[model samples]
Target chain A: MTSEHAPIIEMRNIEKHFGSVIALAGVSVDVFPGECHCLLGDNGAGKSTFIKTMSGVHKPTAGEIMFEGKPMHFADPRDAISAGIATVHQHLAMIPLMSVSRNFFMGNEPVKKVGPLKLFDHDYANNVTMEEMRKMGINLRGPDQAVGTLSGGERQTVAIARAVHFGAKVLILDEPTSALGVRQTANVLATIDKVRKQGIAVVFITHNVRHALAVGDRFTVLNRGKTLGTAQRGQITPEELQDMMAGGQEMVALEGSLGGTV
Target chain B: MTDTAQTPEQDERVKEISSFRKALIRPELGGICGTVIVFLFFAIFAGNSGMFNSQGVLNWSTVSAQFMIIAVGACLLMIAGEFDLSVGSMIGFAGMMIAIFSVSLGWPVWLAIILAFLICMSIGALNGYIVIKTGLPSFIVTLAFLFILRGFTIFIPQQLENRTIIGGIADAAEGDWLAPLFGGQVGGWFFEFLGERGLIEVFERGTRAGEPVVDGIPMLIIWALVLVAFGHFLLTRTQFGNWIFAAGGDAEAARNSGVPVNAVKIKMFIMTAFCATVFATCQVMEFGSAAADRGILKEFEAIIAVVIGGALLTGGYGSVIGAALGALIFGVVQQGLFFTGVESSLFRVFLGVILLLAVILNTYIRRLITGER
Candidate 1:
């Protein structure tokens, strides 16, 4: 993709903190349409912090977020959603006991009128959610199945389908496959691919290097409150990416300094 | 995971009711079982002399009606993830308001009942307002209301020259205008203790086996059934009920999902108050008297009914039908104990057992339901 393609969502100079601990600092990333932008980091490397900032679960201490090239500040998660931003958290923000239809259209439930009486139209919600899931090649039981009965990968697929159904332009996924087994992780990655093909920009946050390499078009690494860098597919290899994210050079310097002191 | 290859249609049906078998172990189901146990004990211990007696059934129904009415609204509040401790005192206050107005001020009974209902509803609304505006724990707010209502009941009677009983409300079966206003007398057989408010009749049935069944059933039972049915329909069929469940399930999630949690909560609080008002009306009108002591510990009974009905104290899961059955279970215990020759004073111990048992059963059911997935 060239600079000619306007990014769907762009964050500039984002900063966040919790008391005296700086969670993120001056992190910048852009998500282009039909592209997978992976935000990579090790534990405590500000990846979760970045996702929260983007999802409006937490406001940046200082930064500008541009959606469709328009400046805005989201007051809360709902605001972000209305602006066509949605998230599939690692924890899977869905009621497991509720039916798949309920979980999929939870925030945006469908309703119909019967002789001026407003009623919950289960049929519509069911068909639409099930159809959307089916379109994504996610086969399962009927829409009325309890979400809790689904596999981790299937639930993630439902979450992605939900975000897409809600008209999300910039989808942010926080380690969607982190809890899945090997084959399940592959299934979720396939979902990420399907999501991108729908022309929605995706911010894929993950610690798994192989998974990211398989799906990511642009990669941004976060290390201790700052952006290490953003690179195109050709700009970095999977091994080099792993080394940088793991603090390969930084660890060497720290070890040298400690050794000199001893 | 079923052994059968489910067609889409069959799968749809199964998905819709995959939890059908699980209901057998639900908390309310256990309460239903307990009701059977208590009834069997009564039948065996006292036989027709106690278990199948006409007066016995009427006695239990009357007592349980209070909890059923109050618990219906409490169930709504609980579904919205809140509580109301002031219902008992609200009952007293409502009764007193009618007594003071109809007796001392010489106001008509009809006006007094209307005024009493309105006042109760207003207080309920006020409680809701305070809860939402401050975002405080509803437990404390309702407890405070309980104390406030109790205080007024105690202090106001003495100031009014002990004339809290007017036109036959104090002494049961006095001809207070309230009696006929609720339901008229039936051929030599009227609940005269509340007095003839005006001989109004709400239910009637043909003689069964040549028994004239005067008005046949308690007006309170009919009302409870109506309200319970209405409440059940609302929870299962309406958007508002959906909102209540969502709100209780997770307030933050609901808010993000576009539910008006604060406004809905306030509305639920008021609904509870309105229910309390209805119970007070029935009790006062039936006995043709209204006074401060009319409502006592009834609020706790309502909450207990809710919990026993399968509602979680921690909020966000239960049914209105469950609450109604819970009240029935409670009714059985209270009335059945009389047949079992248990001391009325030990009712608290019996209730404690039910409470503990309901909690244990509820936890297990919840685990079973959620963990199965």
Candidate 2:
């Protein structure tokens, strides 16, 4: 239903090459407002390269990025971030030893001026951090608790909540559930669902078909630096998506050769 | 997992830590504990030795102020994930620069001090630049500078005056406008009043009879307190302080989060250099000369103080107050040994033992926070 609205972000014919390696060959993806667009791929299927280009970590060798109907060029990730594109990487980009509130506002800290000195507003930061965490449904023991003490799922939630609080319009999550347990994965997927309902476009990249299908409204599969296809929810089945992620016909030929040998 | 949806006050997952455990995780716990133990030991063993008397207290306090100066710099730099092995050398070099300019070259004393600061801080900036550009470890980069600066300290004096020691700096600096800020003492009248009331010891048999033996506080001690207070406030209350922690904690993560890691590191290096120069100026003013080897091994002493203050060798976590306490311990122990009729050389052995114990404590605290075995 949201597809009736124009895409909040659009990429056209994006190509990236790294010294004789074609990491992304004219790959493109469009994320709509209030949609979870899952980018599904196998280990070396160019998903990482594609998202890196989208988030301004890498300049596309050839392509144009349209952000909200205007042609855009990002000089660096900081530029992309200021434009409301936030990437929560596989490592989560969080310092584990810092307090939760500190990590919550790493770059964009809140300060209150006392006389001539500008001080970090601890009361405001703590209140906002706790309130945001509560909204994400993860109750912290305290804002001062180190992020390292939190579970993996809770850390992901912190990353997500930080992005949302900072007013990120496009949240790019790279393999967020790859290292999580079953229960944790469910929590993250639920968090994703909650985030999407807030009208932010989420670019969720992962290899797990089940996790992708759990919350994704639109799915795009990349194989060997090329888009295999894009499908809306209810237009594709789990087995078909899994087969595509496994390189579809390539898996069939490998099995044939194995069968002949047996 | 879904239990997170419950109100935080009623949530079982939000397990409140016991106050004891909470206190144990503080970065200053080890330093505070070490301070208490050392003071108690000194009181028990050196009580009658007058080690706690007015003049005796001033002696150890002045020495502690020296360590406190450099430890403030080292603590901040270490927390920012870099090492400056050239700090001691910078001190020697800076003092030598001031001596050469003021005593030999006939420059005004204030100008010499300002020039020395500029030159040393530039070297600090260069250290940061090379480390950042080459992606080399700061340990190696600063180690190289350690030798380079020390070499200059010796080479410059020898070439200028045919001697590695320069004198007449105090004479040249006498009555200079900026010299008093570093070398002067304060509160003379208060001490005189104390002596008049017999609250403090007074000279008994010299031309200075009836005057308090300990007249006033030295500027070095004041500088140390100011630096510590400034560092504590900066680390705890400012945005730049948070950036320092982030830059040291994880450079990649901090960069990804939009922190200017390189700039923060460079600023920290410059700060380290500034602290070293302050130390050198104060020392040169007090002693009336500069020698090439004056600050030998002071770099390691500063680092040891910072580590003993409960900072991790890996960086990102520390406290300036803790480092100040560590310096206080060093001063008390170094002076206490002499007062107690013990071998002063035993101080080195104590340092070794205490350093090992501090590392053990820091590791334990690290595990406590990280929940690692």
Candidate 3:
């Protein structure tokens, strides 16, 4: 568990609510540098709400988030970004009509000042985008090509590379491989591995146990807005992880009853 | 990853196609070709009527200049994913403001011009604010302003002067240092030299005897060119321009990517308003008067020009240069019809047909480039 190294981010008893609805309750997790921490859950299991709180999309109703062993509170996603925590959302947050370089450096654009004018440093942006993407194993045709022409997996890789290049200490990916094809899923998983090797902590959220087993060093399962438990990679088997994610005996009994009626 | 990667061989093959052919497939290519075809069509049919002469060129260039000014603004706004239907009415309103302030209220022409810009830009900011705050389509919000401003253009003038027409703008603006910059022709000496050398026609019957009719380039054309260049640079070379494309392409995505989508869109609206005011300033100065009905249906003309320039009506893809060419095509067809001795009203039919054809061609080319099925 690398007890010698302090965890980069630690959450204690995190809780979130939307009006009368309890979206999450007492979900706690930890992310360490150079580790892929997979968060597994079923539909409506509050996995999204938990990550939203961690990434500053939503404020937790009651909890303590410690970043680098210091209590942290983010007012919004921008604050998280400034704090070196980057989240690549499920939609990937990409403008399809924009060029690769533009999308890559969107908010953190590089500029070249000429007298009184600050112009987008096209050559620098294009070169850095191409180089960073190449490091992620994506050989772009050119930085000026529209992102719409890229595959879903390539777009995800671009988002990951952008986060890494921007010096993110913790990269949170929300279902990065859910909509991808089999090969695309592998490509994205490989990109996550590459990101981890760069010493950035990755919070990989997914419902797919196989994908988690492939890249996860630790797994945290959530059910009905509460964390079931956390397990190290070698400590838990995929089948056990799958059952825990599906609610174990409760899910089996429901299936048995449904199968009998059918 | 290997499957997704483009091999160097394939990359080389992609480079094999000439950049010219690549350029030919761009959205603006249609506008360039359309401009050429339209220009040649008019030149061949209206050759005997001076359609190709300096006099005819100056006449159409003046009209094209006005449209180009607003079209560039419209093109930028459309790229930023919003519409300002109030631009036409904004012209009338801004013109009235200038006339009321300068001619009626006896303010300095420069002060009045600045005041008019401030007021128009405020209205534009309000338009953007309401659209963003209420989450309503800008089309609806600006459509309401279109009527509201048009009504005010008349009502305010009537309230102040007891008439809808505000006159003496030229007299009031006379002797002001800024007047010539916004109003007068620029290349008169050069044109006169050409006329003296018998290289260009010198009108024998109009104005002073044997004076060159074309004179210098109109201020409107100069302003239009400057704006086009500025708009092109802003859209292609600046981070703000990149934000504009992101804002229009997907507002949520742009926001998530840390782009100030709201700010970009609001600025686009303000720019459109500013352009409308510029148009009003030029027209009022050149005509020496302001009318409540000035710039009627000009919003449609600007949108048409933008669309013909290869911008999508839906937003996110366009160019200022293309828009300038679109305005030129419009000007040629409009003046060419006059030179051909055809009824000017037929210009509307031509506009409609050209818009339809250009949109169709643009869609086809976009499909080819994007490989959209």
DockQ of each: 0.24, 0.51, 0.46
Q: Rank candidates by lDDT, best first.
A: 2, 3, 1
Model 3 sits at a Cα RMSD from the real structure of 2.9
Worst 10 residues of 2 chain B by lDDT: B1-10
lDDT tens digits by residue: candidate 2, A70-135: 999998888899999999988846888889999999988898999999898889999999999988
- Where is model 3 more than 4 Å wrong at Cα? A243-250, A253-262, B1-18, B205-207, B371-373
Q: Sort the candidates on DockQ, descending order.
A: 2, 3, 1
Give the distance in Å from residue A105's predicted Cα in candidate 1 to where it truly belongs.
2.8
True contacts kept of each: 0.21, 0.52, 0.42
Candidate 1 runs further than 4 Å off: A2-4, A12-28, A40-64, A71-76, A127-145, A178-183, A207-211, A222-229, A237-262, B1-28, B50-55, B98-137, B159-213, B216-219, B339-342, B345-363
Number of backbone-clashing residue pairs for each candidate, in the order shown: 19, 0, 0
lDDT of 2: 0.90
- Who wins the TM-score comparison? 2
Report the lDDT of model 2 for residue B318: 89
In the range A66-118, model 3's lDDT, one tens digit per residue, is 99999999988888888989989778468777788999999888999999999
* Candidate 2: segments with Cα more than 4 A from true spot: A253-262, B1-15
Candidate lDDT scores, in order, read 0.77, 0.90, 0.88
